[model samples]
Each structure stands twice: as C-alpha cells, then as structure tokens.
Target: MDKIFESIEEWMRNLLTGMVSSNLTNMFTDVNEKTGDIASQVGQTPQGWSGSIFSLIQNLSDSVIVPIAGMIITFVLCYELISMLTEKNNMHDIDTWMFFKYFFKMWVAVWFVSNAFTITMAIFDVGQNVVNRAAGVINQQTAINIDSVVTSMETAMESMEVGELIILALETLLASLCLKVISVFITVILYGRMIEIYLYSSIGAIPFATMSNREWGQIGSNYLRGLFALAFQGFFIMVCVGIYSVLVANIQVSDNVHTALLSVMAYTVILCFSLMKTANFSKSIFNAH
Candidate 1:
C-alpha cells in the first residue's frame, strides 16, 4: 500500500509539473512574438503598410479633392487680394510693390495646392524615419528574458504540491487567453491609426489650399499639426511597449508564481490602455485640436 501511494504521488507531481511548465512556455512565447510584431508594425509608414489603400487614397485625392481645392484656392486668393486692397487705404494708396507682393503670394498658394500630396507624405516620411530608428533601441530594451523566466518558473514549481500546481496551471492558461485577446486589441489600435491617416490624407489638398491665406490659414495649420500628432503617435506606442516589456521582464517568477503572473497581466493591461492614450497624448503635445 505504501509503495502504491508513493507511485501515485510521483505521477501526480510529474503531470502537474509538465502542465505548469508547458503553460508558462506558451505564455512567454506568445509575449515574445507579440513584442516582435509590434516593433515591425510600428516601424511601417502609411504607404508601406498597404500600397493598394495608399494608391486608392491618392487617386481619390487627385480625382475628387484636387479640383475642389482649386476652387478654394481661387476664392482664397481673391479674398487675400481684396483684404490687401482694403487694408491699404481702400486701394487708393496701393503701390507697384504691393501688386508684386500679391502676385508672389498667389504663386505660392498655387504651388502649395499642386504639391499637397508631396508635402503630406514628407511629414510622414520624417515621422517614419524617427520611428524606425527608435524601433531598434526599443526592441532591444523590450526583450523579455523568456528562457530565464521559464527556468525559474520550473524550479519554483518543484516546491508546489499537486493541488497548488493544478491551480497555477489553470491560472496560466487563463492568463494566456487574456493575453491573446489583448493582442487583438493592440492590433486594432495600430491598424485604426493607419486608417485614420488615410482618411486625413484623402482631403489634404483642401487644407493645403487654405495655408497661404492669413485669415483661413489656421485650418491648414491645425491640419498639419494633427498630421504630426498622428505620425508621432507610433513613437509613443513604441515607448509604451518598451515600458511594458521592462516591467514584465522584471517579474520574479521564482519567488511567487501567482504574483509574477498577475504582474504580467497587469502590465499588459496597462500597455493596452497606454496605447489607446498615445493618440490623445501626441495630439495634446502638438496642440492639434
């Protein structure tokens, strides 16, 4: 009877040990993959992410928005000329240099309207350059020490009884599922930002037309600021990931499995929430709204 009970206890311990180790390995693997995915996604520019969508946006801007922009430019130039004449003694004291200045402003307005897409893309190019450079450093800093974490986890599990190990295995499984859902949310946030950039690009010409006018230039100014905000929002996302990785990497699983697991889950939750706030934070810094 004593020998039989010993065998039973050994079997239960071994089974639970495998179960706990397997669950932890899977969880850490998912986290590492997700970190890599985020670094890749955040480094992409608007056009590189989906050329088809970019081409569609370009075509729509050229065919539909550019002509409307031309009309807006015409009206703005007329208003500018009228305001200029009115400001200078109601056109009675207008000099030759004043006419030249008006014509120069008109030429500049036309140039801005014609090259609207180029200007908008240049902003994103600079932003992408910054993000790409940051990605390398951020990726290195955000690497979770998966092997060490798993080894420590296994050692800790050796001290746990079968019942405790059973509970821990279940907890890890649940945490892994929660992480999968959080990964989906992270993807949504990244993709949604790109879609917003596309929408903003679609009507870019209209705002560029207004930029040369003194009174109406605020609209164009605000639009450009919003573009910068959107572009740099990726940088803020990368920062959040870096912070989350550091927090999770620092978790001490050998000391307490439950505490370590909960810390990881809490950090992931914080990351998602921080990601959602990045847009608002970027916009606030640039005063986009």
Candidate 2:
C-alpha cells in the first residue's frame, strides 16, 4: 500500500514540476536562443504580459471614464460659477470679463473631459519612449550558465533507486510550489499597474479642470508626472531584471543539487523584492510627489 501511494505521489510531483518549468519562461527567459537571456526576456515583456490588460484599461477609460468625468466637470463648473458670482459683491458688480473668463474655463474643461484617455495614453507614450531609449543601451555583457543545473537535476531524477527518486521528487515539489507562488506575485504587480492606469484616466479631467487656477494647476501637473512615473517604472524594472539575468547566467552552480536550487530561490526572492520597490524608486526619479 505504501509503495502504491509513493508511486501516485511521484506521478503528481512530475505533473507539478512540468507545469512550473513550463511557466518559468514567462518570468525569466529568452525565446531567441541567440539573444542573451536577460535582454530578450526583458524586452519581450512590455509587449507580452499585462500588455492586453493595458488595452482593456484604455478601452474602459474611453467608454466608462469619460462620461463620469463629464459629470464631475459639471459639478465643478457650477461650484466655480456660484463662488465667482456670490463672492461678496461680484453679483452686484457683475462684469463682462468675468463671463468671458468662465466661458473659457468651461470650454477647456469640456475638451479635457472628452480627451482624457488620449491624454493618459500620451503620458504613457512619453514614459515608453524613455524606456525604449534606455533599453537601446541595455545589453548583457556575459551569459549565466544555468542549463547545467537543469541538466543535473534531470539526470539525478532518472536514477533507478527509489530512495534517490523520493528525495529528488521532494526537491522538485518544493521548487514547483515556490514557482507557482512567485508567478502569482509577479502577475499582480504587472496587472495592478494597468488598473492604476485606468484609475488615473477615469478622474483625469477633475485635475485638468483646475489647470487654469495657479494653485489648482499643480494638481494636473502632478497627475501627469505620476502617470509618467508609472509608465517609466517598467523600464527600470526591465533593466533590473536584465542585470539579474546576467548575474544568474554567470552563477556557478556546483554539483550539489540542493545548493544550486537554493541559490536560484535566493535570486528569485531578491528579484521579487527589487520589483516591488521599483514603483517607489521610479516615482522618486520623476519627482511625482
């Protein structure tokens, strides 16, 4: 009965390991075997993962966000009118210039509400241009030799001995589990940014409505700055990952399978931490505050 159970467990472990190894390419890889591991994967990700999510957000912004912004514009215009007309003696001293000024503000606010998504995309475009320039300079000097680690693990797993198979199976199981968790963590970061892009787009006009006022103009200014920060943040992240890939490519994995696996795990943990901090780091660079 014990042997039968072990056989079933081993089969399940094989399935899990297959799934993990298959998906690892999404996070770290170069499909073009010619291109060094880091550059290929880093460059590919902008168009690959969460890219469609960005498109979805853009569509949603145009369809749902613009109308909502129109309503906010209406309220703000009404409030501004009430304040300007009722302030002290403005009603008694109604002037032609005041009417012209309010008319201009209303026209500008309407334009802003209508074009919120285009403006949001334009900010992202600026950021993407910066990243493209940065990527143009990013190259891997040397490649890390991790193929041997996979090779060795595979060779060990092929052994006929039951005890060794059990041990290796356990290692594969642990690695697969870690990979699944890491995949989810990375996915959230990538997709979360797209959601943020839509959020910034949705209420975009509220800030633009105040752009004519000296004090309130800063709000629109800051929003654009933050949007750029979000867009360019990916560039920095890609650079970091590329550097990490180079480091990983060069790591000397010894014959000790456990040590090699542990080293890989350490690298992965550091990557996740670095990625999590990229948003704040890029925001600082753009002075989004």
Best by lDDT: 1
Count of clashes, each model: 0, 3
- How would you encode candidate 2's per-residue C-alpha lDDT over 1-289 as one tens digit per residue? 9999999877866764454344333223431132233233333322343567657766676676666666666777888788888974968988889989999988987887677667776776676666655555654343443355555445544543455445555664565566557656766776676566657765676666656555556887888788878887768876666565666565553355556556656766777788789899988988898
TM-score of 2: 0.61
Per-residue CA lDDT of model 1 for 1-289, tens digit only, reads: 9999999999988887887778888888888788778878877877899999999999999999999999999999999888999998877898999899989989988998898888898998888888887778877776777778878988888888888988998889888888899999999999999999999999999999998888899999999999999989988988888788888887889888999888878888998999999999999999999
| Model 1 stretches with alpha carbons more than 4 Å out | none
Evaluate model 2: give its lDDT: 0.62
lDDT of each: 0.89, 0.62
Model 2 CA deviation exceeding 4 Å by range: 1-114, 132-169
What lDDT score is found at residue 20 in candidate 1?
A: 75
> Over the full model, what C-alpha lDDT does candidate 1 score relative to the true structure?
0.89
Q: List the residue pairs that clash in candidate 2.
A: 144-249, 144-250, 145-249
